[model samples]
Target: MSSSAEDPNKQPTLYDSSSSTSQPLLSKLNTEEPTIRPDPPDPDPEPTQFLQISYNHGPRPFKDLPFLILFALFVLSTFAFGIFLIFNRNPNHGNVSSYTYDTNSSSCVDDSLNLSLLLSSNNWVLFNNELSSSDFLEYLIWTLVVTLILSVPFCFLVLLLLKHYTKQIVYVSLPFFVLFPIFFDVYWFVACTVSSSCGDSFPLLYRILVLVFVFLIIGVVVWIFVANWHRIELTVNIIGVASYALSRNLGLFVVLPLLALGLVFYYAPIVVFLVFARLNGKIVPKESDGEYSCVWRQDSWVPFYYALGILTMLWSYTAMVEAQAYVISGTIAQWYFSKEDSRPRLSIRSTLRNAFGPSAGTICFSGLLVCAVRLVRAAVDSAAEEVPGFVNFALRCCVNALLASVDFLNKFTINFAAITGEAYCSSARMTYELLKRNLLSAVFVETVSTRLLAGIIFVLSTIYAIAVFAILKGVAKLGVDSYFVAALAWVLLILVLGFFVNVLDNVIDTVYVCYAIDRDRGEVCKAEVHEVYVHLPISRSHRSSIVPRPLGV
Candidate 1:
């Protein structure tokens, strides 16, 4: 905004210089006529004002350190309580060395199991009932089959729909995501109320739960895989080129699969199963011999912290998923834009350290965000269970829906923190403005890329699982159970594919974040989006800041 006296006839035009140079210098002005400044006019006042919070430069209210610490402990306490409740309610209490965990940090609960008897044998007891464990595997298998059936079209349809109606879809999906939880509870309450007796009521409830769980898990999984399809596609297409160019960093190829395996070992079957049991419905606790209580034989502090550590480790993995994605994006961007790069020096070790080390807290914060949401959901779920009414359950669902919205919004804040090295609330204020500015692109890229990559990962994982299973069965001679190999395979694929694909996930995320922050200003020459990609799910544009370069640029 020039303060010089302006001609009354000169209309305040939104100037954009035809000059392509990003770093503009007045000395390089060829002619007197500065056709247009190209500087983006100030952002729309509505969005900035709409997103204004108290968090800003001159803040002097209170410290969040103590609050964060207490919040972390509160989350850990919930998990610890749940674990204690699980153990106390178990029918196989005598079988479990409940006192042993007091001494042993590793084995909190007895995992003594015959994989053979559990997986292959027909005679098996589940939860003190005659139901065979095979049922679970079958259910999982069926769910996978159905997911596969729906995934192909579901993924591609999103691509097309986003192309034509990106804004509408984004707006619709967000609100719909919030409403889904409410619908889930309303239907759940209805189902439970339909049955009066314990025998009929519980089974129906369980069935409905399992089905709903399957729907959600499958939908979520499929969406993620397909959204990130580009990463795998990129890797396959450029395998020779990238491998040759960055041969020194070739270890990433080997390290990725191994890391995937480690992540899989931690992520799959057990964690997923336990989460399902906890969230799906309440497990029937077995009868205690004398008293209906198990005294805390040891300090409860130990187990709770242990659970916290576990949560930290798990969420840290997720956090790195975002960070490493940033790393890859920066690397590729450098590679692509460098005009005279004989060989751009990159110490992979140093890069990894920087990504994970200094940004460790940011990563943890991302995880904490998840844990916080889960803790809130747990509290709501507990209340819903204790007070059997549609009203309570509906409220729970509404809260959950809002939390889901929060989680979506938090990604931008997390990205801002990751790049700019800001605190949570600080990043949040920035995220609010960013979203208001580039809401459509943010929604499209995050939603589409995540799902695309996840879908691709699923397919790749299935193939990898098959290969691994065959090798294990034939060579190792460890034919150790039904769907164990398959399930393990799925988990491994998820981890490996998820980790790498999420790299693309965060890349797309970061690029859009940058776009949002840049706010229709600057030479976004590096982000020369292709017309074809402009229609693709993840890269779809909203006629805003995202300017697509002609293909083959």
Candidate 2:
């Protein structure tokens, strides 16, 4: 029988026939099977592009060495100069030269007491006075020693506290500790200068102590610089960003809005006060008393100049922000364009579009809206003259309340957006969330409730001012001729009361906020986990064992 026609069993099934074919169809079909062929070689993954960011690491190793040497020479030169100045000068320069005689005296008599009588009668008083100088010097020296001794234990205690709460302490306290030397140097220089000017000698022991302090300060500075290199860079970057923003969008977003707001909330009130004074035939207060003076007036020009300088600084800061923005944008653009995959290119465009496109317009629009509101309020206040005191007071209160609310809202929105990395378009919504989140935690509400607390503070301040006015008016009715006395009393009372109140509020707020965020939530939204690359401490043996390899030649 022929192979193809002999038996029915010899006729292949469809699958078998296809498998036996020269094309090997079954293998092709199996390629699609889940269990079968290898994953198409994974197409060599695109290389991950790295970002190159350059920054000033720290002062050059020996940049300050020359300064240090110069400073040392200056100190020595000053010390020598001071000694020469002291020794060469006449001691009698400070002494009473002569007693002046009045021509109108009825008689001139030889009234000189006997030397022995003068010595004996006031001898104890003279001796006590002489010893008082020595006693003061001894006391001063003892006090200094005691202060230094106390500081040592205090410093040690602070160090222990820092170590115990390193995570919390590092952000705020460590910087202060690192910068303490700089502060100490300033204090020392001032002290030395004052002493040298007053004919006090710089002791050898003090000089040695200062030299040791200098070296220790240098070491501490170096350690801090090394430890916070990345942080320093980040701070620079942030400053740059702010500067760039300020420069590019100055009048449109920052200056105009701020000026407009100030005109409405701050200057307008001063103007109202001035108008009230003029109408009531009272003398308008000076700039020092918070009255607005026109720029053209000579007396007011100094304050105007000061304001101009501040405005100039703001402009300069804006320019810096613009520069930083440009730099960052250029860097991001370059990075995106240089990527191997198209995905990153798309992402970069999207990011830019989101950051600098429609969102910017929205921000500007919001600023304009705020400016318009401020302008309207100013216009209304300016136009009104016969407004009732209660109405005016209510209006002022409303304005202040609004400003406080807005400021709080601004802060809350910024913090919330930063924490979430999510842009919230609605300010009202953001404010609500902020209020809700804070209220949820009793501690948070107690501490950091700026808007509510500020409102309360304003009310209390108004009440205090009224009380002060009443007291001063009552005192004036008591036949006092001096306005200075009344003013002094008023100022002293406010200062003493305000300082304590502010301190108490700040302490409570700070403690509560810290507890709320750190202890209550267990999520530190304000702080981010930063990955730092530090050189692992390697033993000399391990380092030595790492042999150098030859070139591929």
Candidate 3:
């Protein structure tokens, strides 16, 4: 067989220069300018076309190992402290009774030292109690179950809609996104002015201030859309390809929900720790009114434990989210590099192995950064309430801006990490340089695809919630608590559907990075995708300097 027709995956690999230098790791996929070497003496030498890609085998060295160790230590210490708090009996409560069914009594049951009861936590308690009263907890569980059941088919429907109506959805949703807030503000203002009922509630000055703020926000939205109008076509194409890729990898839908379920299980122990923390406090009787209150023991470590618990929750949640992104990106990158007609079988198992098995530390490191930002935001919010001033407001704005920038950059950084298997810092630097070279701002698609998906999910979830509300109230004869049931349904549907959209967002990032690599290497990994993405407008500065004609041009 001719060398051109040889399986590229079997060829001897060229040593990557990126391993030795600070160059972007993925740039090794293809060199922009090939180094010259003397031709081999073999007269039968055949020209070959190949891209050297290596598959990672077994377990690789952990990236960001210290962060992983720190997170594990925190998890262990928090659980140990929670266990101590639960088992440690309050010396003052000598004979506090264990919680049991006492039909004859109507007072609050004081089960101070029952470790099992405290560990069972609020959810189980609420489930048992609410079963008899309004059955609110039961209804909520059923509502969430129904939402999960419906979300699978609903996501497939969304994929179909996006595939067929990408342009229509973007054009239509962008208008609604812009106009809805404006209309809402205007209607509220007019209602306050015309209706005596609400008119007395909102003072003139307050109403005027709200209107001014709303106008400023709308102005910013309009400016962003107008500025990126040129890039909307490219965004539509990317979303279209993403929808197609998602459709091909239908199993991706399950990956995220399963990850989410795992996340819920992870939180169960944390929830127990939080509940037991409060229960561990001592009961102090009030001197003024003789009422008793559970006051946390005056230990310095108590406050620190609370803070640690919060950080643990946020960090674990963020890490789980990053893991999801990594899995999706890895899967999509596999699909992107495959041949259109004769693509190899893609295995999400391998992708999962790479993401969670080898690169788990990278996910932990990224999650820590996000968790720290959230901690800062929470502190700023508290301070804002305590010290309401210009300086405080300015600080809050600057901090929030920093948070947004990190989040935006992290999205692609994680995607690139998924592709290259590099550590977080190295992947971040490389991803930034690649995007800069391509002149592709991640901001344009962020404004369009995410908002459009969010609008669709919101509308569908709200409609579904309302339909459930009607059934609960009209058919089941439920009372006001039916609203709560419907609201729970709404949140679940949004969460499930939002997970699906998140997969698509990761697909977009993966495709763009793949395209950047394909463009850089002067090879087309997938021709149809390249044809569509090739239309991405290049800035004039780079267009003049040796822009390689896209594959087959």
Candidate 4:
């Protein structure tokens, strides 16, 4: 009040005697009789001050511990199953008989011989007994031992190459790589099959040439290995590096979709049968020979619609395969020049987002293939039913086989599209050119690896199904019906087998395509793969020229 009265504008001074009291707060606030005050809390509290209870922490969701454990278990299981499949005589509980593991038949004919001679000598079984199996268990043991022994050096070599590849790979084609030929080839195959119509099957020369191509490619590879072991090492290193990247992102790329599709495919056949049965009661189950065989009572719809549905399914499968190629090739290519340790992490949600949209093109491709084949197959079926004989059967088999081969050629288109991100026709053209350039290696790897793997995986999966049957029927004695158990095992086996082999297939194809297209990078040059060659086991050639490098240096 006094200060305000003196001067409104003047600031009140804290220690000015005239304007304000010089308050010595410590002395002013002191009590005369030592008044007691509540003690301030200690800065360092006592350890026992708080109550600590061990409450139940509920089971965790997809977190670190669970994921780690699950991943570990999955890897171990996959490895164990893979080893057994590779080595054992994939026992067949389904037939109380398994693999026709007969070495005596195919052993006499050498795979090294020319295609014509090989075919003349019953080359039908030329590719049979691929792995050594005088005694299945013995072969398995040796493979396992050899695998383990080579693992260390193999890993070291891969690590070195990966270090280089992390900063070397580049894109050659535009960013639209995918589809017109996917379904296009299906149409082409159908047209060809029908044009050549009736009872005349494909020439044995076609088969012979195919077999020769496979044999020559593999033989050349072996020769190159002996001559130039380094090429093999480089090739392996590339595969290893690509495989590692693939495995890291495989959840979104391969496994999830495969299982989902497997479930759909497995159930679709049953649903179709039920629908056909309910509508017409014509689809009847008759036990013929050793097992229950269901036949759709002949009318217009039985074979026509049935075959249509089947063909449509095959096309859908092809599309999915193409889609898989898109994701896999991109992932491998994108990470090709990245540091191995810090390669791009594939987020499942985001990868799905990216792949799902583009996948529609492939789906459309499949639908087209299905439609074309549907028309052609209808004719084929009508003719076959009218004229029942081996000729018709042979025609059906040969045409269908051709269809299958043509369908598989989509892989080439897929590889091109994946790398260049180009449109379908362009990709196919380029893919053709690239494969033409790297013909031997590309064909050999694509066909042989996939075929070998398919057989192994099929055998393995069948064995798995039978094993499950044994467990459920013989040991567990579950109340579930044998057929139900069989169905469950069969479906699960399909999914698992499909997942494992399909991954390898895509990987091999992508790597080969990438290597082939980059062939022109030049003498000093842009061949991203050359960086890998620069590591150890260097090659002078720019192309992955099927030449093997020396074994060691």
Candidate 5:
């Protein structure tokens, strides 16, 4: 057996034994070590620990410390200024003055009345003598210093509040509420101090102070607008809600249904007026005496164009006003009417309280009434010479002024009516009552329906008047006895042209309103459901793969 197994030629071939032994050696070598020298130990990863020095770290804390110190200084300065103002001794010791420190001066009391009546009655000189006698310059400086000091704390507080709340309503409104009163007070002090001391000769310091405060006011306004950018969207939404509510509450009774009626009755008549104006053309040119022929041309259609423009403006105003009124009415109702009751309550007592309190509404109303009266008087006086029939002209002008006043009053009154009506009735009952009573009130109905009508009438009358004057002149040149029929024709043609222009305007306005509604609503939709996608770019460190792969497979 040994002989056979050990036989070199007869035993297993060297090729077969060698292959088996080599396989085991290869397997051991592959298992024990990598062939590529293990990437030279990765260079110990280059010592990644680093010192990050940030300038912002120490500087941030230090920066805030100065602001805090400045703020504290400002508060102390304000306290000092207040004490100075309260206790400053009057230099003129012998003058027993009747000047009462009245903080409760009625702001709503007519300024003109106070100037004309109280100042004259009390024998108070337009310029108080005491103001010039004292250290007025010092007081002015003190005023400015006080303002600056107060503003620092105020600005700091505003910044803190804005940071804490992070709401647009507070951010926008708070600054205005804070700044307006401060600036108003500063202005009051400056004006009173200046008028009392220097009369018309305002000091350079006063002017500088005014300019600085103006700039500050502007900055505050800009900041408010910027901070409350998001609130603009809210405002627009509020406007839309208001408009819809108005349509639902007021339109069904007063405006829309009446508008429908006007469209049915007056619209046709207006269209006819336009058509007549279009058909009867006026003289484009007329010749005068030979040597220098006078070229007489008439813009018979110009009145129509003016009319149309006016109508468009009026309609736009009415729409905006109505929407605003709805908003006011709803807000008032929610705030004053609906609380702690099954039905809405008027709370006349609260209303009276607000009227008497320091609010803008009473001031605005009184101011507006006074201005309107002044305007009417001025208009009447101005038109006295130009009008052919003075009394009739005055009456017409008065009527126009009265109509405008009514429109102004209507804005507030309609809101009042809606509130009061809602208070008296249940929501269901109120809705029905508002629809019924508001519709029947002819003045309200007609006013809402015919916002554009007055414009149309005024344009036609103006055009007719111009055309008649032109024809009278032309006839006088031709010969004063030239037929009246021709002059009448010219006037008719002018009126017709005015009507056409008005109609064209109405059509354009209708189209614009439709487009605006679509655009506004479309914006609302886009804002509501718009999708935004965010993408983060890959950094260099993140680009490396976790596992290594063979270069060429």
Candidate 6:
């Protein structure tokens, strides 16, 4: 037995050994290698490694490069054309020896003054002189200075109010929004009836038509309110969230205004060019005796140049607005993604850099698309006016529908681009897909918020304007047409208020897009916000696993 155990060929079996030898067998089985032979290795040793490319969360490659190049070319061409017009002006090209650059002075006077005053001062050289005088300019400058001084504080106050009292403002404004249209339509109907019955009486059918239209509008307004009742809460929350974001990023106020002011300065020279293009015409005799008018030269490129300047203005304006939206969206997105404990790297300057640097091409591309749509719509509308028929009307409707779709798509595309730093087409594609997935949610957000926010801005702006006018009345000595100056101030105030509201609107949009992204990724960003927004309409198939936590007080 000892010899058998010592032999390597002999196997250790429990049956052959006594109870004491069982331990040795077990130890041998545990310590020794297996009896079964290993299978042969495969022929190839190297394995394939898969790589994935995903949407960038950081600065991406410059997108819409060709559009950027085209934008540059447009600017250059516009300036070149303006220079050509300035240098190559020929008085004899159209007809006469003299040139008159003041083509719009009469129209300007008519537009600037009230109707009664305009009729009274049709030939009032003194009135025209007053308009062009240095003293009047001084007064205008003073009014503007006062308005600017007032507007800044007022805008800041509006921001504060929006941040702290968003729900109150929304609740207060919705009634006004619903009522104003009805009130306006009713008042107009009454005025039209009175005007027709008392003075310059027209057909009774006209009044009937007006009454029917007013009723229809009022009905539509009521229906809209009833339909969107459930969404009001969500809209308010969205605005509240946006207000919170804006309050946190207060520097945006200064940056956006500066950008708008810069755009104004840029367009000043373009206006001069437009004025010069008007001067590139020849003096010609009118049909009336001892009368002359400037007939633009058929051979001259003035018309083309004028159109180009107008196009540039539209494109540039769209680009600036998109850029603002981009900045706000990006800044808000950063705020959304940042962890509560981590030091915030969110800077408006960095966002601005991203917007004007790598993302500029995207902005330009979106702006170009919008501008093209607007131009097409304008052209179609003009043609429709010339040729009034069902066919033309149908065509007009089709064009309008197309333009509206583009405009709507362009808005969210910019929002997505700002957030992801993606190219224009890529951003648009993603945004469309995202919205498609959450169509009802997107519609709910857009429909419920726009009217209410617009109402709030309008009311606040009007109140601010009225106060500004009162201040101007007390301070300024200009006796007559003070309301005109007040109206100017009012327009400026509206623009300021509109801009602030636009920032908030962008914030709302960005939040929605970010929420969509987080849900898709099964990540919870800004858990507090998610708690509020997760109640939005979501399809069963696309329901996310991101569980919202209870909000901390």
The best candidate in terms of lDDT: 3
lDDT by residue (tens digit), candidate 3, 21-132: 4565457556866879996765532221122222233356668778788889988888888788778635544323443323345323455567754656877888767675
Model 3 stretches with alpha carbons more than 4 Å out:
1-59, 91-145, 172-230, 279-300, 343-346, 388-397, 462-489, 537-553
Q: Write the per-residue lDDT of candidate 4 for residues 1-553, one digit (tens) a residue.
A: 6644666576645455663557644555574458788977657643322312111122212212332343234334434433433343211212211122224542122223245544555744544444333343343344345434443343334334433552221111101011222233344445445665421465545545554565565555445435643343454445454555555554543445664567487546534443442233233344557544434344443344444445445455544555566666656555553444574655333334434543345434533554456567778889998899998899998888777666666666655555454555555665564444333234445543344334444444444555555655664444435535555555555555556557656766665555544442222212445454344322233344333222232
- Model 6 is weakest, by summed lDDT over 10 consecutive residues, at 45-54
Cα lDDT for residue 17, candidate 4 = 61
Q: Candidate 5's residue-wise lDDT over 494-535, tens digit each? A: 344333323222222222222222222232211211110001
C-alpha TM-scores of all predictions: 0.45, 0.22, 0.72, 0.40, 0.21, 0.72
- What's model 3's overall lDDT? 0.74
Could you give candidate 6's per-residue lDDT for residues 137-165 as a string of tens digits? 67677777877787778777877877788
Worst 10 residues of 4 by lDDT: 169-178
- Candidate 5 regions exceeding 4 Å error are 1-280, 283-285, 288-296, 299-316, 327-412, 420-553
- How do all the candidates rank in terms of TM-score, highest first? 6, 3, 1, 4, 2, 5
Q: Report the Cα lDDT for residue 256, model 5.
A: 27
- Supply the global lDDT for candidate 1: 0.48
lDDT for 231 in candidate 1 is 47
lDDT of 2: 0.36
Q: C-alpha displacement of 445 in model 2, angstroms?
A: 35
Give the poorly placed runs of model 2, Cα more than 4 Å off. Answer: 1-210, 224-327, 330-357, 361-553
Show where candidate 6 strays beyond 4 Å. 1-59, 91-125, 128-148, 178-216, 281-299, 435-440, 462-491, 539-553
Per-model root-mean-square deviation over C-alphas: 16.6, 26.1, 14.3, 25.8, 34.1, 9.7
Kindly report which residue stretches of model 4 are placed more than 4 angstroms away from their true locations once superposed. Answer: 1-245, 253-255, 258-318, 337-341, 345-359, 370-405, 438-441, 458-491, 522-553
